[model samples]
Each structure stands twice: as C-alpha cells, then as structure tokens.
Target: MRFRGLLLGLFLLPAVVGAYLLAGSATEDGTPRCDGIIEEYGDAERSGPMKPGETCDLYDFADGRSQGTRSYDQQRKAQEAKASKDGLVGGVCLVYGLAGACAVIAGRRAAPAPPGSRRRPETAPRSRRGGQAPPIGSMSTRTGVPHTRSTS
Candidate 1:
C-alpha cells in the first residue's frame, strides 16, 4: 500500500513543483540590457531623497520611457502565488492518482470464479425424482384412482 502511494506521489510531484516554479517567475521589473541607456539602476533604499533609476529603456520609442513606481516589489506575492499554485496542482493530481490507485487495487483484489461455479438457490430443496409423484382420477371408493397428472 505504501509503495503504491509512493508511486502515485512520484507521478504527480514534478507537475506541482513546476507550477510553483513557473508562477514565481512572472515579474513586473526584469533584467534587460540596454546599450543605449545612459541612466543607472539603483536600489530604492540605497538611493536617497532625490532617488533616480531606470527600470528599462530602448534607443527607439515614441514614449521614450518605461514604467516606474514608488514601491513595486512582487517577491512576496510571487512566492505566495507559486506556493498556492503548486499546492493546487498537487491536490488535483493527488485526487486523480488516488482514483487510479483505487481502481487498480479493486481490479487486483477481485478474483474471477472458475467454471461450473454454482450459486445457492434461494428456496428450499425439492424432490429431484422425475415423473408424477402420484396418480389421481375420479373413481369409485372401491377403485383406487391412478390417472395421469403433471408433477410440476
């Protein structure tokens, strides 16, 4: 039983881990090299009151700018989302895995009966002797009747 459970876990664990890993990778600010950008990048805390930084920029752009924010760090949200997504995937996989395991177990446990196997009758036993039990017919009291009649 434990071995089967382990196998099921093996089948589902990677998918769950992948979901978490991927969910954590979506980021608002990313690392991009811009050869044309003269602006420097600095940490929010390191830069003082007159802080200046460039998240992203390219040589050609009508807007000539990228997004900026006073406070924008998605590390916590990303981690939480990753963990939840992983847990969700794990849960779903677990359900299907458990179902498969149950089906396999039931199939293994049920044994097919051999040929000529007889089920017990619901009613009491009856006389197996063929032919009429006795004969009956209209006759005088002196003549003992022996007429044909159905047994069943």
Candidate 2:
C-alpha cells in the first residue's frame, strides 16, 4: 500500500511541476498581445514580399495615424494562443498532481485488514429502491420467516 501510494505520488509530480511552469506564463489582463493582421498599403499589385529584418512603413489604426515599421507592430497571435493553452493545461495538471499526491499519502497511512477475517460483516441485500431487505442469513428459504436462535 505504501509502495502504491509512492508510485502514484511520483507519477503525478511531473504534472504538478509542469502546471506550475505553464501557469507562470498566463497574463493577468487576459488581453491578446498580437492580432497577427498584416496591413497592406496602397497599390496591392505593387506590393512584394517584405525582406527579412526590413521594416515596412504602415498606418496605425489604433493610433489614428501613419507610423513606424510593420515588422515591429506585427503580432505573434499564434504564439500567444499557444502560451494561453499551455498555461491552462498546466493548471489542470497541477491540480490533479497535488490531489494524487494527497491521496497517496492518505492511502499509505491506512491499516490493512488481518488475514482470515472479513472486513465487514455481511448484511441483508438492498432492494432497487435502496431499502434493506430482510436478513437472508437468519431467514428460512422454505418458510420465508426469520429463524430464532436463543442463547441461555
């Protein structure tokens, strides 16, 4: 039982650590940093593939004026989404991991029953509605009545 609990705790430890790391990346404001929209200037036909490390002059819709390079303003929306997803998964992992560890610890402390003895005494079977039936052990099958046993 102790070994089983230890194994369960070890298995869930990774999930707890992973969830902690993921949760760290989550934003408090819940606002996306990048929209990933590339704005095209006048004359779409004349526009060509922007070179690497090259800055394109573009209009800023938020600022209501034409401003700096498009490369700098370009949003990594995909990356942000991935981060958010990872954080959520991590949080879930952390919860399950901690819960599993607790369960393991609790299980390790419980006592095992002795051999050749039932854990609990058998009782009358329950009905479909959850009501207890008459005790089968003391009842007579032929007469459908309880047998009396006297101790004097």
Candidate 3:
C-alpha cells in the first residue's frame, strides 16, 4: 500500500508542476507603451494662485500615461487571478488525489473477511466467578451453575 501511494504521488508530481508552469505562463502582460502627449490647455490662462493675465501650458501628459498604465494594471490583475485559480486547482488535485489513492490502497489491503470465514479461533467462555472456566459439563465453583456449550 505504501509503495502504491508513493508511485501515485510520483505520477501526480509531474502533473502538478506542469499545472503551475502553465498557470505562470498564462499571466504574461502584453499592454502597449504610452508615448503620446495631450495638450489640453495650450497657453491657457492660469486659474489658481497666480497674477492676473498669467499664462501656462497645462499639458496633460498623465492622461496618455495612465491609459497604458491602467490597461497594464488590469491585465496584471487578470493574470494574477488566473494564476491563483490554477494554483488552487493544482494544489487540490495534488493533495486530494494522493490522499484518495492512499486511502484506496489501504482499503484494498485491509479488506474485511468474507462472511462465515473465521478470523480467529473460537475460545471457551469465561466463568462469571472471575477465575479459569470450569471444565465442560461441570458445576460452577461458586454459583453451582452447570456449564453448557455455547451455540454461537
């Protein structure tokens, strides 16, 4: 049974590792780079905490940068989720498969005896007087009861 369990574990080990590798491979990020710039307020008047008639170039560089960043983040999160799910699946298969295999092996090896098959030899019934049983067909030592053979 132990040998069988070992063999089963060895067989499942490769599958478990393969599952992990596949999950890792599935998490590759492919988002494009953010290079373009948006000029939302070109030479526009400055509004806050500045002298009157002040002008500034309020270029919105972050808008274009955030697009690629957001996409990359979303893809990264999706990849992580998929990797986690696959890892969980692989772990469950590894643990439960090995445990179930071991249990089945042990069950088969320790199967119960068939009906009417004697597992142990029958023994003489003990006396209630708390000593060795009296001989067959003899009276009890203390209670004076006659001993009889059991029908079981």
Alpha-carbon TM-score of each model against the true structure: 0.32, 0.39, 0.34
Question: Ten residues in a row with the worst lDDT in model 2?
Answer: 28-37
**Higher-scoring candidate on lDDT, 1 or 3:** 3
The C-alpha stretches of model 2 lying farther than 4 A from their native spots are: 27-75, 113-152
> lDDT per residue, candidate 2, 20-106, as tens digits?
667566642333232223344544322234434434454566876756444532423444567787787787777777787777767
**Candidate 2 TM-score versus the reference:** 0.39
Going through the candidates in order, what is the number of backbone clashes in each? 0, 1, 0
Off by over 4 Å in 3: 1-70, 112-152
Instruction: Sort all candidates by lDDT, best to worst.
Output: 2, 3, 1
lDDT of 1 by residue, 19-108 (tens): 444454433134322333333444322222222243222334466564432221232344356556766665565566556656656654
Error of 3 at 18 (Å): 8.5
* lDDT values, one for every candidate: 0.45, 0.57, 0.54
For all the candidates, what are their Cα RMSDs to the real structure? 15.3, 13.6, 15.6
Look at candidate 3 and tell me the lDDT of residue 150: 92
Q: What is the overall TM-score of model 1 with all chains considered together? A: 0.32
